[model samples]
Every structure is written in C-alpha cells, then in structure tokens.
Target: MFYKEIFSFIAIAITLAAFIPYIREIFRGTIRPHIFSWVIWGVTTLLIFVAQLEDHGGVGTWPIGVSASITIFIAYLAFIKRADVTITCGDWLFFIAALLSLPLWYWTSDPLWAVILLTAIDVAGFGPTVRKAYQFPYSESLLFFALFTLRNVLVMLALENLTLTTLLFPAVMLVLCILMMAMIAYRRRVLFA
Candidate 1:
C-alpha cells in the first residue's frame, strides 16, 4: 500500500516535471514540436487514459490522465507557435485513421482489445515524429523523453493488476521514448559532426 502510494506520487511528479522543460523550451523557441505528432499524442493519450482507468483503477492511472491533459495543452502550444511544424499528407491520413479507430474501439466487446487497438494507433501516430526526428533531431527534447520513460517505468511498477491491457501501453511508450531519444542523439551527432 505504502509503496504504491510512493510510486504513484513519484510517477506523477516526474511526468509533470518532464513536460515543464519541454514546454519551457517550446516557448523559448529552442525545441520545436511536430504539430501532427503532438496532436496525435494528445488524442491517443486521452484514449489511453480512458483505457487505463477501465483496465486498472488505481492511483497509477492518474499520471496517464494528467499526461493526457498536458499533451493537449502542448498540442495547443505547438499549433499556436507553429515552430518546426511538419505535417505530411500521410500524417493526416494516420490521424484520421486513429480518430476513426475510436469508433472501432467502442464497437469492440473486449476491453483489452480496445486498449490494444488504441495502443496500435498510438504507435502508428509516432511515424510523423520519427520522420521529423530523423530529419531535424534537435527539434526534440531528449531530456523530456528520458524523464517520460522513467515515469512510465514507475507507473508500470505502481500498477496493481499487471495485465496485458494495463501493461501494454506504458511498455510500448517506454520503448518508443527510448527509440526517440536515441534517434535524436544519433541524428544530432551525425548532423553536427
């Protein structure tokens, strides 16, 4: 019980802290976010928040909920600032597909399947960001992604159910975060070298 509370608080704090620098950098015009990616993330995170609540009703899910809210705000900032915004046609297609999947998720009988579909869409949404990161790596904040990966780890530990439905999203996000971080680092090195 005590450990759960501790991990929950830590996860939420780290998740929020991770975004602070990213948001600050965005305002400072240091890190320019891919608007498509942020928009997709904002929507996907909100869906994941709903799925998490259904799969695991505990304090661990609070971080995801908070993250969803923050993601929306960041998306708004990205839209308004329009810094390094890259939105290809395919990116629009992916977003539409993801948005369309919400109905499919609602039509599904299994909660786990709904979560799985949402996670797949979320992963697919990363394509735009991955392409952007490959082209312009410095536009992203590596520290923010690193901290997010850590927060996901803590949130995973805090989960009470530990089922596939509950575990898959965060686990996938952790890997994606690490991949994005590595891509940014490698691209930065190659470009700057």
Candidate 2:
C-alpha cells in the first residue's frame, strides 16, 4: 500500500519534471507542440484517468490526471502562441474520432470499451505530432518524451489493481512513448544526415 503510494507520487513528480521544462520550451519558442494533438491527448488522457479510477486504479491514476491538465494547458499555449495551429483535414479527422470515444464509451456503459476506444483515438492523435516531429526533428524535446515514458512505467508499477482497465492506458502509452522517442531520434539522425 505504502509503496504504491510512493511510486504514484514519484510518477507525478516525474511528470512535473518532464512537463515543466517542456512548458518552458514552449514559452521560449523552442518547442512547437501541435494544437490538435495536445487537445486530443488532453481529452483522452482525462477520460482514461476517469476510467482508471472506475476500475479501482487508486493512486496510479494521479499522474495521468495531472498530465491531462498539463496537456490541455499546452494546447491552450500552442493556440495563443500560434504554434503549429495548422488545421489539416487529417487533424480534424483525429479530433473528431477522439471526441466520438466519449459517446461510444457512454453508450457501452463499460470503462474497458472507453479505455480501448480512447486509447485508439489517443494513438491516432499522435499522427500530427509525429508528422511535425518528423519534419522538424529539432522542434521536440526527446528528453521530455523519455521522461514521459519513464513516468508511464512508474504509473504502471504504482497501480493498485492489475486489471486491464487500470493497465491498458499506461501500458499502451508506454509503448507509444517509446515508439515516439525512437521515431524522433531516427528522424533527427536522418534529417541531419
């Protein structure tokens, strides 16, 4: 019980560690976050956190809850700073798909389906940021993604319940973060080469 709580807090701390600098970069105009991606991520993340709590995830959901707010704030910052506000048709597709998850989740009356749908939408949400990172490898902070990956791992470890509902979101996010990090590194190398 105590260990789970500690791990949960540590994960939250890591989230802060990762996001504070990322936010600073945004303010400094060093990192250009895609508005659509952050908005989708924010909405999905908050919903996923609710699903986790419904599944008795307990303390593990804390980091995700914190991330949700930060993600939304980043989206707001992107909009205000006029960073990557380009609304591609595909971006609209991703956003709409993400919004649909909520109604689908409500209709199903199952947190699992919600997590699954939201996770898929969240994955799709990565498309714009992934494209941006591929085009301008220098615009993202790889370390932020790395820390986020680590934070997800910690979140998984801190989970009180080991059910799929509690585990799926962080598990998938962990994989996604790793893949994103890998793609960013490869893009940086290929672009500079």
Which candidate number maximizes lDDT?
A: 2
Clashing residue pairs in candidate 2 are none
Off by over 4 Å in 2: none
Best by TM-score: 2
- For candidate 1, give the lDDT of residue 110: 73
**What is the per-residue lDDT of model 2 for residues 16-60, given as tens digits with 9 covering 90 to 100?**
999999999999999999988898899889989999899899999
Per residue, candidate 1 scores C-alpha lDDT tens digits across 1-193 of 7787789899999988999999999999988887777787888788778877887647777788889999999989988999765678877887788777767777777768878888898887888778877888887888999999999998888887788888888999999999999889999999989
lDDT of each: 0.84, 0.89
Q: How many residue pairs clash in each candidate at the backbone level? A: 0, 0
Pairs in steric clash, model 1: none
- In candidate 2, how many Å is residue 128 off? 0.6
- Stretches of candidate 1 above 4 Å error? none
Count of backbone collisions within predicted model 1: 0
